[model samples]
Target: MTVRAGREFLAIPGPTTMPDEVLQAMHRPALDIYSREMVELTETLLAELSKLFATKGQSYIYIANGHGAWEATLSNVLSRGDKVLVLESGRFAIGWGSAATAMGADVEVLKGDWRRAIRPAEVEARLRQDKDHKIKAILAVQVDTASGVFNDIEAIGKVIKECGHPALFMVDTVASLGCMPFEMDKWGIDVAMSGSQKGLMTPPGLGFVAASDRAREVHKTANMRTPYWDWTEREGPEHYRKYAGTAPVHLLFALRQAVNMLLAEGLENAFLRHRLLAEAVRRAVAVWAEGQVLGFNVAEAHERSNTVTTVVMNGNDPVSLHRYCKEKCGVVLGVGIGDLQGQAFRIAHMGHVNAPMILGTLSVIEVALKALDIPHGKGGAEAAIEWLGESVGA
Candidate 1:
């Protein structure tokens, strides 16, 4: 008989394990939509959200997912036929650009090596070539979770400044925010978008957008603005505009608790912890790769993401490996998406994950590799243990 025990571990890149504090915060009954308590929660939550993004600019919360945030951002800043320079580092950025296209925005994508981060020099050169300044915005992902590659958003911003480009700098931090160092204001990001599920340690259904004064100013002249996504109307003094109507009361409570936990732990500490865990995972993967059957999808070490690690299986079938781990070991792993389908898998080391949790995931993966006779070097778990033991914190 197949036997499995203990809590099933979810190691997917998104919809990460939520902290008990957040779950408990959302467990209660919904509050009155217009009550003073709700108003206070809304005020405190928006203020803290601003601090979370490291921005003094206005932030709006929506009862939508990251896709909605992408659409909302496009509508708020671009009009029909406006030009946007999209940096295609991976699948998601292209998806964002496609959303812009659907909104009647003209998108010019800079095809990049899928395995590496976008080169700042290339961005600078491209912007310099646009002497007429036709590009209204440059859209990129801080970390392309699909490829497990992290781009330097700050470097991109600096390049834009070097070229003297007036285009708005926009970044999608859906997978990187709270897991890594992302300073929206410090990075000179005119607009930034993120979702609640990944690094925020909250349930899905909440989308966040932090807009600088320039992005808001663009909103005034932006012809594509719709009532639901109009930044001015949403950010107005009216309490009803907070959610464009009644608020997602319980989500606000959960977010408040999650933000409190993150602040208490300190954002830097959180980033370091995620970095250390990701390194441990990498070390383990390195050992496994010694058998020459496994390899990293991302070729460059510096470009690797701190939130997720995508592993190439060479000739092995990723679907079978994922199925074995889920059914036999009760460890859920992220399936490869886009170009990586059937060939790669992902290990997420973000959100509320800790050493023991990651160690358990590594151990299970090692066992599955052996059980399935997948060619892998011995001692992957040992390598992970050694690396994790060397440092108490990062």
Candidate 2:
């Protein structure tokens, strides 16, 4: 017998739980593709996106996901055989670099482990060594979900400047954008890309890129440019060119509502909410870690991201815990991927999540551990509640 009948909770990163208002906003009739309303919608979204990214640069919307945005950013600024420095904190940035390799850009990875954030000193040393400035661009992710590591983007940017490296500093904010503080211009990010799914509280399919003047200048001679992902083409006079084809009307509507909600909450408040919820989850995990089987994937406490927490299941298969949570308790957690596959599970507390949602997810996890006879510290869920009580106040 299972008590799994309910609106199943999704505690996975990306494609997170959607707010009722956002879903209601999408339940509308389609708009005329050529109408003034459509043009205004595109304009407003671009402006709002730039605001969200904290960049004064021009923002572009694409009919794609995070991976597509990777290509768009690459093709817009670098040429064939352009050396790209990939600072690997986890899987996503390496994946972004691999995409560059497939596109003919020479990729070099500054090797980093999954358990820790990227070291700024290593990045500076690498950049200083590139005397010829052969590296055209630097790729990094503000947060890597697979390893649950949060790279210090601001620190890396400062290092790049200190080394006088001319390579464009591009960042992937897919997992951290709305959930954390990311000052694009202030952080010296030349090009930054994110998806609508994770922190933005929208469904997948829309990718956003904000480009600084420096990146746009490089676009002029970028041989990797193609018509579909071309920044110039997207900036054409026609409204249709904004997306390169028919617009994703419903997704735009969903995004607009989601952005509006975020703006209403204020980005700072949203960040705090994510932090509190993430910490509550962490508190529970800390208690469970005493079992000797459950532990955090990220070794450093400070490096843990506010978006998702990856729990490593030592000497145990996470699949059983994952299945027990979903099938018995109606809570779906994120399964491990990349190198950590089968060794970990993730608890996501980003976007549209509140104290109860996080607390409920933790409670279900504790229940699953108990039901599955997995050894864990008692009162894991109570520990989460105590944290919320102390931190959130009455």
Candidate 3:
């Protein structure tokens, strides 16, 4: 006997809950890929992509995912043996560096732990050590979902400029783009890459990359350029070249609606909403952590990301709690991956999330703890409610 009949709440990081408006927009007949309507749609989305990324640089749409955008950025400005410095705060940047390695570029990792954000001073030190500027590019992620860490892209970019380093500063905004503030041009980001599945509130499939004029100038001599991921090929006169082949018409429809909703809400308001919801989750988790078994994965309080919260489950198996939440309460939480796997569980408050969705997830988590006999402080959900009440006002 359980009450898990309603629609299951998805609290995972990426591939977040799609809005009904976006779904409705996709429920339509296919359009001619060569027609004027299709060209207008493509042009509108391309211009909007640059706006979302906060850049004056040219943006390209790709028929791929975040991983494919990684390759596109690397192949555009880097050569066969170009040295790339990966500022590792968590799994994704290291994974991006690994992709560079596979593509025949030499990769060096500025080692960092999952418990904290990347230190800007350490990045400056590393850049200063590269006397001859062997490193062609620096890679980082605005947010890493696995560790639930948010890196300071602006600070890192500033340090790169301070050191007078010529390496291109590339960022992966896959998990933080629409949920927070990211100024690609103002922050000195030479190349930026993102996906539709996270903060953008769209389904998985489309990838985007914005390149600065400096990066584009370097692209002329890049040795790793291939026809498919080549930036030049995508900037052709034909509409088909924008996507390398046939366009993803349905996904584009969904994305356009999603972006429209984001703009309507305003980016600053969306950031505040994500911040408030994330703080509510943190409040509940703080109460639960009184049991000593449940705690935050990030050591510093400020380092905790507004998009997702990683809870460290010590001495207790997170899988049991996850099972109870799904089977009995119809709420799905994000399972930790990479280095934090088996040791943590994440609560995502990004994308199409509101106060009730976050509060419900927190309530179900509290129920799961009680049902599983896991040691946790009582009134975790009530704490979340109290926080939202005080912060959100009336």
Looking at candidate 1, the ten consecutive residues that score lowest on lDDT are 1-10
Q: What TM-score does structure 1 among the candidates reach?
A: 0.98
Error of 3 at 208 (Å): 0.8
Off by over 4 Å in 1: 1-3
Model 3: residue 139 alpha-carbon error in angstroms: 0.5
In angstroms, the error of model 2 at 221 is 0.3
Model 2 stretches astray by more than 4 angstroms:
none
Give TM-scores for every candidate, taking all chains together and pairing residue i with residue i: 0.98, 0.99, 0.99
lDDT of 1 by residue, 1-394 (tens): 3334778999999899999889999889989887888889988888888888899999999899999999989999999999999998889999999999999999999989778999999999899999999999999999998999999999999999878899999999999989899898988999999999999999999999999999998989999999898888886777989789989988888889999999999999999999989999999999999999999999999999999999999988888889988998889999889999888999999999999989999999998999889999899889988987887745
| lDDT (Cα atoms) of all candidates against the true structure | 0.92, 0.94, 0.93
Give the range of the ten consecutive residues with the poorest summed lDDT in model 3.
Answer: 385-394
Q: What is the lDDT, from 0 to 100, of the residue 27 in candidate 3?
A: 99
| Candidate topping lDDT | 2
